[model samples]
Target: MRFWLLCGAALAGTMVADTASADTLREALLQAYNVNPTLTGARARQRAIDEGVPIAKAEARPLVDSDVTFQQNYRGISPFQDNGRSISAGATASYPIYAGGRIKNSIRAADTRVSAGQADLLATEGAVFTETVAAYMDVIRDVSIVELNQNQVKVLETNLQASRDRFDVGDLTRTDVAQSEARLSDARSRLTVAESTLTTSRENYRRLVGLLPGMLEPPPPLPTLPQTPNEAVRIALDNNANLKASEENAKAAGYDVRTARASRLPSLSASTGVSYTDYLGTLDNVTGSAAGLNPKDAFTDSFFGLRARMPLYQGGGPAARIRQAQALQGQALEQVIEVERLVIADARSAFGRYMAALETIESSQQAVAANRLALEGTRAENSVGTRNVLDVLNAEQELLNSQVLLVTARREAYVAGFALLNAMGQAEMRDLGLDGGTLYDPIVNYKRVRNKAWDWSDDPAPTTQATRTATPEEDPRAQGPVTPPSN
Candidate 1:
């Protein structure tokens, strides 16, 4: 009896260790947000767009430039003279008084493009979040499968031992013993496959999150879905990033048209410049007398001028540009329409998948319950000699399969919920109820770094520690012999 108690305690300890070693889903998600390459690339692209704001604002500011000219003139009259040497220096300042409405429209277009860039970054982030959640869930499901299969193998091993004992006593036939062994072998094979699958799933999760896989706490329960697909479609159409980007694009295209049309109007500007030159030379008259020129022969000139340029005729160039801009505007409008259609389709598909996953969860739960009962009954019949060991093995296999299916169904349901949120462009970390208190915010960190919030520029680079580094247990490329399973 003490031996049995010790075994029970050992089993419980193993279970506790396994649970403690697992990483939670939220931790995996945070890691993924921090290290995901796709997201990092998108953020860099957005910063590039942010620079456009300063560039566009620069257009309305004044421009200043200077030029210097050195010239040696030979009049063929004085080869021995300085030959009217002159050094000219000039500076000019100009400011755009007006370009009709072209400059303003162009700036507005740039602003809208910045908005589109932001939307694109958000969309990419949403995509990465969705994928990370899916992969994390996959690892969870695979781990559960491995656990279930391990349990099944344990039960089969126990049954096989019982069958062998009974066969030695002539209470069970050789056939029964053979059947029990076959079931145990099959269970062992399944356990091996489950372990392999769990390893692969862990690697996938690690790749996305840049960390080792750990025990995952089950996600919180989801809210009920919308009652109608139309409701979902409406929400998505209003909030989808792709749709928002398209709308911004259309606005930018309209601004382009404005810019093109403004080209036909007059542009006004003001300019000022100052110039100085010194000329030293001797002029020879036709009477052959040499005359010395005054050093003050060079004078400084300063001028300020206002000018207006009106487009007259360009041989159809202005009209052609206007027509091209109009065409592009039309194309943008059509793109908006196309995006609307796609948004609706995506909403419908996600809603359907969510509903299907829900149904599967229900059916799978029922199957698990039914299979458990069937296996229990088969074991009782076998004890009474009314059923053979093969019947029991078959029932056990069915139960194991049903448990795996149920785990998969639950995972699918969770993923489907997130997918619906993604389709609606509402799958942010905050929406997942994972906000507040050290939650990793990519945008916040990006802004902090970009705006120099922390003064990290002054920090020294980190040095490696002298402590020993730990090696991961599950290396896919290792070629050593496989270890036998612990009983």
Candidate 2:
């Protein structure tokens, strides 16, 4: 007989009669990557941050504005009054020539923050992917547990019927029957709990993967693991997305300080514009036949000049801004060190847990083997009247316990391994080798909008990007595995 009952593939589809197809771990990760709401929102927020670069650059670009005005006056108050009707139109244009590095520094700060935002987006991806892995494995683990408990219930049922038969034949006592009945009842209760846990896990899977999971293939082995915990920590300090984001934030803050200081310096700009006004015969002083002026005659005004603004005093506002930026820059620098500490701690802890879980799995496998042998021996002795029914019953229970422990340990090992990878910054989409579609590149958006100048250009209206967990599979039991899954 097989050492343990293996979890089988689920039905091909949710429908009762559909062909069978199994869901792999890769598929779940891909689904979450494409449409998980949290990750999608992070990407959207990063895109918004990218716009800041262009917004900062715009401060130095030419600004053009135009205006038109129509007026009517009944009272003539000298040559300046246009009583009948008059229209005015004018346009103004200005370009910043210099700002003591304020514009340049501001753009640098925004671009650095964009880098920080991209790092934040990467962290979000890693976080969401980590959760998806946990959720996916949870369903698999719970399903295996439910199946094991179900098998236990069956075994107890067989024991109970045998106990009653033996008692009726005067070979076993009524206490033996009672004991079997009690154990069977307990196994059934445990089975209920296991199935309930399985249901909860399936709901979580649906939340992340956009549907209830079917049979899930075993996850592939983790790659590029560091040989030592110290190595893992070193890698994490260098590559952890959270830490990188903090460092980028610190760099951005430094740029902000420079930008603030530049504010106190004088700024120069060029201004050029044209203005026109039509009297429309309303200026009677200039529109009459005696005046020798045409009703259509208009005023044309043109000007070009350089503007220089030097701040002598501003109520200490610019100084305050500079000080505030300096303070924030220090805070950002401290945050980088703090994040580095956390990354180091996480890398070491995850590595320890993975190692411990692997050891547990090995030990539990041995226990399961020993217990199975013990139960077999106890049955043989009971058949020959050398051992009591209680002894056989105890052996069977021990084997079931060991089987459950082994399954749990296997689950723990896989999860811990994945967690270790995540802590070491090796679990994002690029490392996942997903062929589902093109990976999202934040640079695509940054490049698209960093120099955007069209005032009317805009993206399509935003819609709900994530799939709703509508009508999720209510009963996970119906999709129970039928054969062992391939890793």
Candidate 3:
């Protein structure tokens, strides 16, 4: 019974461990979208922009103000009798009847500003995604190199042992034993460097994603390539967030010019007010009788008025403002054009990189296969005394180098694919198939929180899913292990 209970407990523990270890690349990306400081800061800036919308809209609404005063006097006043104490309260309301479209133009400018802010947020997200993908690829490449070096060390050690045995039997020269030992030492040194590099890459990945790197899973397979460079460029031009932001800024500048032009026109407004006053102590009336009034028994008076004002001249102020706005509009227009050109260029560059990476992967795969065959042949020849130990060691190193190159090329290809997606502004969490519903959509969350529609009191507890899973058949290095290799 004791043995059975222990076995059952061990099995449960193993299952819990497996569950904890299971994660996917998509999950990592969703977590990053939620917790990345860059994304959060961008969203905060966007909310600040939304606040401008209400400020602009308030211009068309009525304005109200109130004033109250209380005074106490000990000495008598000669003019109209004496007031020991007095209290007065007044309120005023004003409404703009007309402003020569200045309010409308200002509101339009504010709207444009809000749009620009949204675009800016999107642009920031694109940049963050690009950096994350690059860091992820670096981790994968470095880990793969470390693994390759470790395998190389093992191969060299085996060769050194064989050489020592052969020398003991007088079948190999002392020079061959020395060469095998030297190769083994070189392999160990390379392994150490590779392990250190892998550690640094893992830390960078962890920092970007806001999680421990070991918890992340391998990224999804690369998508199919775009058929033509023009197609890719068109996609980038149409969808690139930075390009959109530039266009929005240009539109906002145009609105600013309109606002400046409108400021030169006339403004009209209407206002009305009512007030009550009371003498809290004794006051002498015209009949010489003392009249006492309390704040509760105040006399009421009412009046209404309309106001009109026009901007005639202010030292060329309006004209200067208009000119400044016009200059800014022109600068914004130029920026839009520049962004379009840049987006197209980025698309072209990413497409070229993807193509080059594809070619490299193909070439490296071939090289790895060829080098493996050569290493095998050299080992066989050394065993039969036809090839020296140095030949085996050199062949093993070549094979290891080829494997490292192949892994690096594959990772580069994957990264370039992501780069192309980002250049086209299509590299969202959803596009990466990381749409775990936990993926942060700033716009949606902003609307919910800003509108006071989110129920903070009843909010659900935050939950997270594992972002990776281990497969028994898959090598840790191939999937990009986050742990540093043991030297």
Candidate 4:
């Protein structure tokens, strides 16, 4: 029966899938950075933003249009008198010679908005990476806790069996046996909870990493950190994506104000047009010219001229718009200040929490060692009849508690370190070395579309899904493991 029980346990263990080639955190991050659906959507949105520059540029270009007309008229009541018929065609072209700087300022505003969009994209990328890291760490933490709980259950089972044998031999009382059974039951209950937590963490991992987690490798050492919170805040102020975006937005709003003011100034434009009409033998002159379809008979006219207009007044609409834009620009500038303060506060808070977690790790390690020794001493004393079974059980529980604390402390230390990196705005691909070949450079797309008046290319725009050429030697997978930057 004992042999069969052992075989049953072995078979149960085999039910879990083998994961010999455990996935590394770096590999998970690379997968998320490269193909996460949220990131792909953001890239597509940025490509749409790149079109705004070209749309604004259209204002300074020419406009051309054409029209054709045909007409027939009947003369008063002479049956054989000639009928009047005419056909006409014409084309007109208009070019804006000057628009009092409105066109230029509009283009400037659009260019600034594109810059702001790129910064927003950067912020989104950072957020996705942060979530992926959190999910990866959660799985690792919960798995370790589950294993620890399982071991505790096994240890309690052994203690319970020993207490039962002792009670039968009169070495331990019924109360001692009852205590052991109670502790074993409690350990089993905790193990069930730990298993549930691990399952939840794995589900979150699947959501972020695009696959259910296999066995995950332990994370490597943390990245280098600043020596002080002040230094971290300084870095955040300079590099935070949200801060940069707000500054760009403020500049765009300033240009908007300029564009509104220019609306009140004089504007100039030039236009040219030509028209032709032919009455194939109208009633008025049909017989006089027997009009051999000659070139001189068709009525034609052409004219070209420049015109200027100044807006004297229009119920103060332009002035009201200018004021509105100026107010919005002020609001944008204040938002920059708000974002800077928020970044600094987060940096300092994460820095403090990380330092506390490091200290807890050291303290918990010492506690675990001390509690382990105390448990051993208590058990030996009970074997020699100097201590009771209850004392031994209490010491064992203390040691288990200390072990759990140590595990939690280590997890907190690693997670807090990453939080600090995120607060400082350094949690991006280039900083983390996750940017493989063919980095998505928004500037490339902006330049491609900004000066274009029309899209005549057979290929689509340079979107995230567009085909890109890469060098034969550039193997993206060979880029090597992503490591933290040196301080």
Candidate 5:
């Protein structure tokens, strides 16, 4: 009980020590949102997906091309030997008049897929934030446990010395002294384990947040939560990113089926071109007189035409493609349901854990108080010779255990609550009110690139957005000797 009370006071003091300068949950999340490699990579991938829309739309636009050809004497197979220096230049332009809906459906599918990619990017953001929250809470929990364990080791050390003095004065036995020493040793070992856990948790925090953690302010209060698991499921089914992405994918796949079916229908296009050819006075090199041969002869030609194509026999490929697309559309539709189920399960499970952890925290607090009183009573009774040293030691250990459990329960409750929010699509940047910096908007990039047709436009070279840090030295936990110290 003293440990818990001390920890509470310590945390309060820490919070007040430098509230303005202290690192916060929002700050940590913002760092990750800005530079976390996983989130950045997902954003880049979604941007690439956005280009699919323009690429598909390109099929419906006009295409213009130009070419020039030059011929030499060695290429002449006719008696017009010096037909050599002839040059031909031409330009052709074609515009789609109709495509049996293939181009339209393809563009629709690509556009819908861009929506799906946006949803996927949203999902990735949520997942990374959840993981960062978990890691933050883990470090806090482990730090508190390490502090408690260190305090216990100190208490046990004092008890061990007292036991030794009492034994020297004939008030205690060797067994009593040995028991105290053993407990102190065990407490020291546990403290070492707790420290190692803290180090590992810090490393994980750095992995997510792009820097080593500073003095982390306690997490802010969670948003209002759903009252029941079924309510949570309802919310998740409506808001879950994965489910939304899957739904869009199913729609895109349906469009793909239509695009494939369009292959059997006749397509029409308009084409026009102008050509210029110059004999380069090759006729002047003619060995014999030829009718209408001019010293310099050149001709210009122009034409306009329309073309229509229909698939008469494609070796059953178009039918197979249609069937394949239909099956995939079915698969995509099924995936939506599958993801919905997962979201529901995740929401309910997280809610259960949060509730359970809250109860454990309450119980552990009570247990801590009880064990604290028990330890005080046992120590007084031992002083009066009514209780043994072993009983007092056991009570102290119980108090420490209860305090550790209470801390852990609180951490778990916080993490689970955040996870529940994540599943419900309420743990994103906008949801968290993280005002640390500008939030990433996938739509801005999507809209900018989706309808672009400029051939000369270019994007800046991609540079890594993630931050780098020096790796920490090898942890003692990982570098210790294989064998235990001999007793």
Candidate 6:
């Protein structure tokens, strides 16, 4: 219909005007990667875990401490009868010569735990990016659907007007006019629903991307896909963060078992100390003896020795701990296997969905083409009196329905492709080519904190002054939202 043609042209013009300010999927994802609180928190948590390595290593290092003691003694029943003051200061150092490998195993366990934390951070990043991609695509898909519904409403309105004209001239019955009116009403209602869906989709986009969506450009194609489901599973097994984390945990648990067993073995250490004592006043009156009865007024004593300890008895606690650790290690190992199986299953399922979506897109395309031709033929036949207004309206409705399905199928295909990538642990900023900002590397923080002790200034300084405007190069999509054209 001419009305439909005009509507399409107007919509095209609106899109072109909005495209100047459009937000792209890549930009949205980049903003999310840079500002998402959950991902930042995960990085912080991993840094905290990295400190455990130094804490465990400290047990194998020398410990030095200083103590000062002061005391006043009063004799007899009166405060002034007899009084003496003594003060002593001492410094002691102890170094563990051997701990039956307990400290070594503990350090190993801590290292593995840090590795696991790093993997957990990677997993969190992937999840956040995956969610951002979906939110970005959802807004674009919903907006397109709304446009399609609006066009349908226009086409039905034109059909209803034509039906009314025909009925007034007795070419069509009143019942036929009513049918056209009822279909138009239905189309309007669907348009309202579609608009509501678009509003919801925009809200979701804002929640993930840290800004409300403007005119969204179409999404880009997904990254190169795996050749087969087996290939996808292979990729997932190799790159999946959850599986890596679980494997590291299992290693840590094995070290814990060793640590617990070592607790029951003998430990050897060496210690040395020097002490100085001073008497503030005579103590003869308090002791009822000579003025320097205790010893020299000022004296120093030095001593050094080796100490050995063996856990001879602890109510069977050490043995029980070893058993508990063994059980925990077994559990961790099983978890690793479980995670691998789940990852494989998820990867295969995602690939299947992606393939199905591609097929649906093809089917919907064919349907749209067929229905468009049918609508044109129905309109021509109606003009020649072979088909009526109802046939034209029905054909138009079929075409509209096919268009809706096509748009939805395309959206699904894109989302499913990303889903497959996510399952294979490849749905991240680097893989998506979303180089909009500085990429966060968890290793930078880990290396800074892993060997640090009693140091808070080791963290990297901010790159820029507290207040400054962003440079043009820093934000690639500063002009507006810009998504790639839909395939």
TM-scores, all candidates, are 0.78, 0.88, 0.81, 0.82, 0.91, 0.86
Q: What's the lDDT for residue 77 in model 1? A: 73
Please give the lDDT score for candidate 4: 0.79
| Cα lDDT listed for each candidate | 0.74, 0.82, 0.73, 0.79, 0.85, 0.79
How badly does each model clash, as a count of residue pairs? 4, 7, 7, 0, 0, 7
Model 2 per-residue lDDT tens digits across residues 391-442? 9888988987877777777677777777777777777887666777899999
**Judged by TM-score relative to the true structure, which candidate is superior, 1 or 4?**
4
395-486, model 6: which lDDT tens digit per residue? 98888878877777777777778878887878765566555567777778667766665634555663421222345677777767899899
Residue ranges of candidate 3 with Cα displaced over 4 Å: 1-22, 73-83, 215-217, 282-298, 430-433, 438-487
Candidates' RMSD to native? 10.0, 8.6, 10.9, 11.5, 7.6, 9.3
Candidate 2 or 4, higher TM-score? Answer: 2
- Candidate 5 per-residue lDDT over residues 45-119, each given as its tens digit: 998998899999889899999999986554356645443467899999999999999999999999899999988
lDDT of 2: 0.82
| Candidate 4 lDDT by residue in tens digits, 1-487 | 0111121111011112234677776778877776777887888888788888888898999988899998765556775655667788999999999999999999999999999999888887778877887888788778777887888889989999999998899988899999999988998999999899999999777777677888776665666688899998998888888788889999999999999999999999999999988776562453344545443546889999999999998998999999999999999999888988888898898889889988998888788889889999998999999998889888988987877777777667777787778778787776676534666787898888888876464245554632223334676745677688999
Runs of candidate 1 with Cα error greater than 4 angstroms are 1-22, 73-84, 161-186, 279-291, 313-316, 430-433, 436-487
Which residue pairs in candidate 1 have backbone atoms (N, alpha carbon, C) closer than 3 angstroms, thus clashing? 22-214, 22-215, 23-214, 23-215
Residue 244's lDDT within candidate 5 is 91
Candidate 6 error regions (>4 Å): 1-18, 76-82, 285-287, 292-295, 455-487
Q: Is candidate 3 or candidate 4 better by TM-score?
A: 4
Supply candidate 6's per-residue lDDT for 315: 96
Report residue 104 deviation for candidate 6 (angstroms).
0.8
Candidate order by decreasing lDDT: 5, 2, 4, 6, 1, 3
